[model samples]
Target chain A: MQLPFSLQPLFDFLGQFTDGPANALIIVIALIKIALIVGGLLQIIPFIILFERKIISWVQDRPGPNRAGPWGLLHGILDGVKLFFKEEITPKGVDKPLYLLAPGLTVAPAFLALCLVPVGPIIQGAHLDALVSFLRLDPSIIGPGGIISEIPLAITNPNIGILYVLAVTSIGVYGITLAGWSSNNKWSLLGGIRASAQMVSYEITLSLSIIGVVLLAGSLNLYNIIDSQAGGFWHWNVMAQPVAFLLFIIAMFAETNRLPFDLAEAEPELTGGFHTEYSSMRFALFFLGEYINMVIVSAMCVTLFLGGYHGLFPLPWEAIATWITNISPSFAGFYPWVIMASYLIGPMVIVPAKVGFFIFLFIFARATLPRLRYDQLMDLGWKRLLPIGLINLVITSGIIAIDLMVTGNGQVELATKWIIGAITLGLFLAWDLLYYSPRRKAQLEKDYRLYPKSAKKGEKPALAS
Target chain B: MLVDFLKGSALALKHMGNFIIGKGNVTLEYPEVKREQPAFFRGRHRLQRYRDGLERCVGCSLCAAVCPSEAIYLEAAENTDENQVSAGERYAEIYQIHLLRCIFCGFCEEACPENAIVMGASYELAMNKRTDFIAEKDDMLDPAEKGFGDYHEYDPYISHVTPESDKSAKGDPWAVKAEH
Candidate 1:
């Protein structure tokens, strides 16, 4: 298979080691990488859940779940343990196999999609060569014979990365639908149907919204996408396609079935939704799947719109890496690794910071917004976001076309100014349409004044007028 | 339409921001930080002692009779030369306050003829066993170091006790207030 332009060097470096019996070592490393990603995600979801509760409580001006551990850090962990010990109850006349398969189906794709999420720098073939030469490790051992663990930050960097994410996440719907249908309970069926319908409706907008960034990045590979956003903040897709960023975030909430978009598991209407009949570890799996999905979506958002790992200023990693190399001849083998670490630390920190910002947004939205009625959810997804996504795509493409035309004549300076002007204009127009308008202020005041009795509770009737 | 949505979002953002940046959290981590109880707050009842290390209860059973919840129980016994538990002619041989039934209304304290019992500031009355809720006379009695003067420093009924009978009772602040 053909590798992406950026990854060709790494492939060539690894190619020398992929001889006969040595190939099995690659498999070992691959398995380890997958394990690390899955294990890290499993450990992280509990904390994310805890943070969600803590953030929501803070927003509501309350201290949430402080008793379980220091600042309630162990609350989610204890809840998971409690869920594990709970009796596994399968109600009468359930499709047992499908019911069992539902949770695995839901959770598998959440982890699968994360393989494409780049958390740090991809170590190139040059770095691999440097490490191999300095360490003076056996060529047979280094190649693919013994310890060939030059692991990239991500598990895999498939060419169809974004498409892979889109496909896996959409498949997650089947799990919910199956769980709901097999439960044979009316509420579970309702929740399942609502979930599938909501996911299906929003998936279109979700994918289409992402297309705006895909066009701007000019690539499907997640690494390439982040690479294009390098240099500075303005170069980021968020600054380029701010409309699409907003659209994608809204659609992401629906896709994840988070609050305000969580019509499927609406506790008041459906006791526990699709997992109503599920108990013990089976029920816990669904919870884990939901939180992991949140992490994936937040990571995706960081990669696509927020410049993944790119900090505000240009990081002097190369100079620092060289300085480390010069200082230690004895540790020359480790210098490349040190360089890789220094280079990766920016992205490793910044990307999580970006993901954390979105996660906070998710929790904040949950704390603030009421769940949209099912019909309202559908209307917003189909009638509102779908059209907005298409429009954003067109706008992004038009800007890209103008950019291509202007840059072809070697007048780069003028083209940049034009793009900046256009972005600012678009942002201003969006701000006006969405937030600040005299018409909206007048309407708000009119609504307030219309409710004279309520208004008079805090003010005189004469003053209310 | 979008403007209204954004306006609502702004309101939510403002609320969240104010909560994060402003000191709006009213949550008190209980068991860590306790709230100050008011002066008239009725809580666990304690038996008082006079300055001479004598029990104040005369075994009149008025507190037990007045207890709306019937939480108090006592047995009267003669105070002799060999053993005198109180300044009065009789003493309570067995005094018990059942905390489970105690209403914490201070009525027992109000009905005490000798001002033997007064509601204390200790409100943590949690007990694991049903039997633990029954506080005995010894558990409820104030130690000898705490005298009737310390207990009735502000007692309203202390003035009613004759000055010739109990010296500490006449110097009550409420007694001065009652005269005014």
Candidate 2:
């Protein structure tokens, strides 16, 4: 189980200083990976905030925070500093314990869930065995029985990756609920209730939506899911599971408390929502939690649907590498490291780019759509998305089951899946354009006609007299 | 529904595209760049003077009488041969306009028989104290050495429209006056 592009060389290098077992070295490497991912994510979160502001402003035809730094890059940092120094107000009669615990609770699950996301591919065939030998390191010191094997790019890859993500993210609503309840404010309570109800309602559809991808991939492990879609862009679950993709994205918005479904934090209705009584660093934590949640969901979407860490077009890397080596024989010695670097760096870039696009979509939706009414939010989650998700799941499983029974291959052909996906999307579009929209408009008009018309133009309706 | 959603998104994307290309942005970057007010825009009031430094007001009190807000105050004094302040028999001895109370309707300018008061283009009338809002006689007086000190001199467009030749051109309906 030799992991392609393993950090074993670095592990071996560090092993020189320690007389500990290989297991200890593995723990140290895992800790380093965790620090790098978490620290990198924390550092990037501020910029994501700035990016959101700038993008929202751009959509509205305004220059957002250009004064903070060049293109307002430092604005998020300035905001963080401001929030840090602000006075933390604990409202009188508030439940102190839950109030103190809520923000951390909201943020912790998001970070924990992030551990399961594979931001890069575990490319095979990039053995650093040559490098290990070149460094004069004995094989016995590096691993059990000196077998150099697979290492995951993710901090941790649990077998139940998607399930773990769902379970952990579900816990986030508790923090919101606790925050709302402990505040002793009606607004916060209303926001918290809304958040809980909304999360619970959408979580059903959110989970249901991903089952199509899970069924197709035949694995819940996020890394395995990504591996299933490793061929190219067309092979991505988004292409095969278009209906599920739509449902998942919509449910994702509701689950994350973002606009169009952000009834929990609907400013007009609930003021600041569950965090209304919160101020200073406590409030900042909630804010941080929301943005982190956004990042996590975006990454999750990429992992599940958008071909995690895979580029749109498949390039002939082996051919390119050979061409480079053939040009100069001296480059042959460093060929393995070059291959490892490509494998390591390629997904590192691609994953963020994909995740960034989804994040941008989040901002784009926020800028474009108005917040859904509370009833409408519930209606969408239950009546619309849930039903659609169920139908999609039924149809998806039906196809797979039929394919397995007929072909005995236990897999639906890509062409058949692609055609079905296209047809499903096309049919939905047609139905929406030809049937649903006009009928909805007519119904709205009929509802409008139920009211009495003004006697004359610009005049009040005549009284019953 | 999807079409409508896409339309709305396209509209926003279009605006974003325009923003990126530096189009359709109405923001003035306010403190750095001020907007140009219209020609007939009523703003701060200024008292005028004649070419020989004689006061334009004849102390007729028409401005005070016509002021809807009663923001103006004045005291008339007889002008003798030794102390000839105006081209008329009397001069405004004491004059003040309480800006805080002023509606800035340019009625005083219209009512002034001697063209003594005209609306200046200085709209930034913020003051630290309530009393500081009151424009004294000297404060409202044009700080000019000679000539009919028209407040429009500061605005090139207004100055260009109402040239030096049109100093006393009154009630000429066909004349090219500052349009709103």
Please name the candidate that would achieve the greatest TM-score relative to the true structure: 2
User: What local lDDT does model 1 show for residue A33?
Assistant: 73
lDDT of 2 by residue, A1-465 (tens): 234555556666665676544655668858978998899999998999999998899898888888877888999999999999999999999999999999999999988998887876653233444444444545665422364455578888889999999999999999999999999999999999999999999999999989989988889999888878877898888988888888888989988899888888889888889999999999999988898899899889999999887889776666777777888778775566566666776447888898889899999999999998788788788888887788778887887787778888766678767865876677666766775577786675555464454467777775432
What's the lDDT of the predicted structure labeled candidate 1? 0.76
Query: Candidate 1, after superposition: displacement of residue A166 in Å?
Result: 1.7
What TM-score, computed on C-alpha atoms, does each candidate reach?
0.76, 0.82
* TM match of model 2 to true structure: 0.82
Residue A254's C-alpha lDDT in candidate 1? 93
Off by over 4 Å in 2: A1-24, A123-138, A141-148, A407-412, A430-437, A445-456, A461-465, B44-119, B125-141, B145-180
**TM-score (C-alpha) between model 1 and the true structure:** 0.76
Report the lDDT tens digits of candidate 1 across residue range A295-409.
8999999999888878877667767667767787965555556676765675467777888888888988898788887877887888777876777676667766777686774
CAPRI tier for the interface of model 1: acceptable
